[model samples]
Target: MTSRLVEHLGPSNISGASAVEIADRIRALILDGRLTVGERLPSERALAIELRRSRSTTTRVYDILNQDGYVSRVHGGGTRVALPHSGTTTVDGDDESMIDLSIASMDSTPGLYDATVRSLPRLAALRGTSGYSLQGLPELRDAVAQRFSARGVPTTPEQIIITSGALNALNLVLATVGRRGERALVEQPTFPHARESLHRHGYRMLPTPVDVDGWDERHVTDTLLHGRPHVAYLIPDFHNPTAATLPDSARARIATTARNVGTHVIVDETTAELDIDRGWAPRPFSAFSPEVITLGSMSKIAWGGLRLGWIRAERGLVGRLLATRPSFELGTALLEQCIAIELLQDMPALTAHVATRLRDGRAAVAAGLARLDGVEMPSTPGGLSTWLDLGEPISTALSLAARDRGLVLPPGPRFATGGVLERRVRIPITLSPERTTQAMERLSMAWSDVHAGDEPRTLALPHAAVI
Candidate 1:
């Protein structure tokens, strides 16, 4: 923020300079750390008032900072700091503090490996092991098809293709069905990697807005028809970042719109099974649009390292996708496939175990965030993170300030559709109870500090990354 001893640049002084010069000075102040991270800037109106410059001139400077990532606004929180250089990882290496709310994913079910080991004999029972088939292994395909078929969507082994993980499945489907430079429809504030993947392939993005009630049917439908999109990437169950599940009505509508408009929909159902509430599973959205491409990953339900996922599409499309899959890696480990096969067979017990842990973990984190002052906990029934609407967007600064206290969080833009969703931050359920509480406490302190105009202080994570 500008010092209280404001420089009231008179009309003559203001007339002597341009907006670009003011922006340059502010930029230098931020880059050199004189302004400090998470420090609020004088509002555009205030700056104009002090500098005797037009509001447009001051606004231009603020816009420059936003583009440079020096600052951003939260929904209700005033503009504060943007993501700091927290080195982006912890000493543990695997957990990125950016991936807050560790409670989002439950660890693998206990009997998963045991079940896989037990299945080896059955796999060894196969007479001959041959080279990779354009189609995945028949036995595994048949077993998976049966599972999906039971959910009211009949599938044949020929329609399924195995890939290293859901990412590969998504890439192949997009490669096959998506055209470069064409708009790909997606939800606002979507998974960051999904957006990156689309960008990597040279496809343009068309992000539609979503809220607690679900997707605006008109907005999505209009985009598909008029935008001339090639792919619709959707996360139908317990979506990442937002933790929202598209209702069945919205699901059916989206699927129908995609199919009718000749847009291939890639549905990512990685978190389909994590609903701790145990509500009735909405029929697989793919069931409503067989022409759509659907992707699934065992990583969320099993383990991230498993690297097992599958694509369900019509048989010919499956072959086309497989031909492109090798551009990435050869294949997922044969062992991981065997593991996923066993997990499916043993899901009854595995689901029970995962459910217990996630349910408790959610409780632990929710309880903690609720106690923080100035934090407005939004009502999200059953996804990993609580969208704590702190009634402000200064979250990015608070996040940076919390770094000195040891917690790292993703800024709101990471999930934005049209570069909106500023006031929000996602807190996944992946964190354990104890660590999450400590993290929240630090966040509260950061919030208090920044809102009160104090210099944002850092937190010490026992293992926080030092840049």
Candidate 2:
């Protein structure tokens, strides 16, 4: 565990920092969702050895962290991660004063209430059975399959497995197919939790760069050919943060390369339908190759609280997933499955509602960026957030500065695998227009503070989970 924590620390320039400064760096890591909550920290001696710093300095670092409620040292458990609780503000609890931008999600869709009320009757019918649906309700799976078929991929209910969410679907796939020592190709500045999941599954990562301009096709094909990673986890449509969709040609090239290399391509389409104004979307990645595994969820299109998602794989792989799923979870909630069926039928309405909200948010964010110098928000017609180029590596500093003013913004580094991407940050379009305007105002003030050389190390930050 200590070795893993040391690995997570990466290449920190800790040689010249004071103990307080070192503590601040670790605190920033915690706030970024890299260190995470409840994880054990390295012992002072181990950390000192790894960092090549004095034992006294390491001891003081832990002391400062403990004093700040960032850690608690149990007599025999070593130091465990934690966050300070306060009456006025808290990381683990609710504090209405803070504008949390950590999660890129919106409120329930306008039609969610009606959908839930309609699903109640279906729920009553399920009481006669054991309520365990390992492959999800038949109706829901058919609905999901039909939607996939409509998108140009021929799918069947037999190839679908409903899970709690997209993340859960990914986990089930990993558990079934992950080879501990194999390599997995992933996107740099990809979904943080997805990266963490790959790490936990023990696949060494081969990161391919993805910027606001989108992916480099040559790099992807070359990596697939040379690295021959066991799997490639990609968000091809409306890529998260950057909102760069892969053109059909690029997808075809990647799919062909993966076939030649015998690499499994796991496509996350959670953000696929998040099209605000992108008039057209390419056919599903599966349409390019039958070997592709696609994960989809209603979290973005509808609401995350619904806790519903599905995986579309080949029939044989779907059988493997169903066989392995009981070791982790029995089945996805039956009620959510029923509700998803209704939601699927009303996707046109849901998409229109989401598109309107995203449009307003995009405009609000653009207006806010205009007030700040050097912060560039790219053309984001879709996806939940836009990746902002800060024009300098001040993302962590700026995040801390924003925290002091009641805006919780995860630094750019949080989105990447290692502690990099300081020149970028993700601002979600999930917020209402009014809240986004307010967040930008606070962000502008924070930018000014950073430029004025106001110290941000002393700022107290609430540690919220990044979705």
Candidate 3:
């Protein structure tokens, strides 16, 4: 745990800072979601050594944190992050109102309500029998397999396993393939919860850099050949945050390298179908090699509340997942599967609706952010968000200030495996055009406040469950 704490703390250059500065930096980490609740802080002596400060300074900082309800120390239990007095908003009062940009889900598709209505008869027919299916509903699994086949990846119903959502599918994959202390290759500034899940499962992450421009294929191939990680997780098509798609040439290199090194690749295609303006669509990563496992979800295309996601792997791996799934969950809900079956049948219509929504959203967010100086938002052909470079390393401070002004922005560090990417932040283009304009106005004001030295109002952040 001490070593993990040191790794998470990562290279803090607070060599000669005052106790207050140290406390503020630590507090910023906690608020930014990098240092989660109940995580133990390093021992005062060790932290003092790392920060090159006196033991008294470290002790004083701990005392200050304890006084402010940011941490609690037991005689032998060590110090842990704690909830603040004002409770979960992280700002004094005003807990009830704020625009949450942390969640990247889009609204339900136009036909979702109709689909739910249409699924009632099929659901009623299954009410007499047992609803528990460890693998998933046969019809839905077949439909999902057919969807994959349509996308140019040959698949069968036997190779598909349904799960609650993409995160659950990811967890199951990690649990099945990952061993304790093994290396897992991930894109730098990738999805935050995926990194959290890897950490929870005891995998040491080796990051490969990915940016708005696109993947550095050479770096990825080199890492795969040398790092020899047990698994490589990638969001190749319409990637999250950055919305950069990996070119086919890069995909072939990654696939060939992984196959040579015996690294299993897990491709997340949750954002693949959200194409708004990309002229060409690449085939599934698994199309290059049968060893690759692919994950897809209806959350992005249809609705997140439906809680439908599926994993496409070899039949043997699917059987293994089915056998081990009971320990975690009984099965996906029967109604969600039925609804998914209905939704999959008319994907053309649903996809068209999604494309229109995301196109307008992309234009609105890009245009709004363009009005602000020093904000660099790259235009993406697909995906739900933009990775914005703020031209400064004030992401955590900006997030804190935004909270005070009634907007919730996830800091850049929230997306990183380590304590880096402080100059970048992800802004979702999933809001209405009007709301996007309003949020940008508020964000501009918050930036100004932060730049002018206005501190975040001290409050307790909500407790996030450990992954």
Among these predicted structures, which one has the highest lDDT? 2
Model 1, C-alpha of 106: deviation from truth (Å): 3.1
Each prediction's TM-score versus the true structure: 0.75, 0.92, 0.93
Backbone clashes, each candidate: 26, 0, 0
Candidate 1 per-residue lDDT, tens place, 386-454, comes to 666767756545555555444556545445533245477777665566666666666665666667776
lDDT of each: 0.66, 0.87, 0.82
lDDT by residue for model 3 over 353-404, one digit each (tens)? 8888877777877877776689888877878788999998888778777777
- Sorted on lDDT, highest at the top, how do the candidates line up? 2, 3, 1
- Most TM-score-accurate candidate: 3
How many clashing pairs in candidate 3?
Answer: 0
How far is each candidate from the true structure, as Cα RMSD in Å? 9.5, 2.9, 2.4
Off-target runs (Cα >4 Å) in candidate 1 are 1-104, 119-134, 457-467
Candidate 2 deviant stretches above 4 angstroms = 12-21, 43-49, 52-60, 72-80, 85-96, 457-464
Clashing pairs in 3: none
Indicate the worst ten consecutive residues by lDDT in candidate 2.
Answer: 87-96
Tally clashes: model 1. 26
Ten-residue segment with the worst summed lDDT in candidate 1? Answer: 458-467
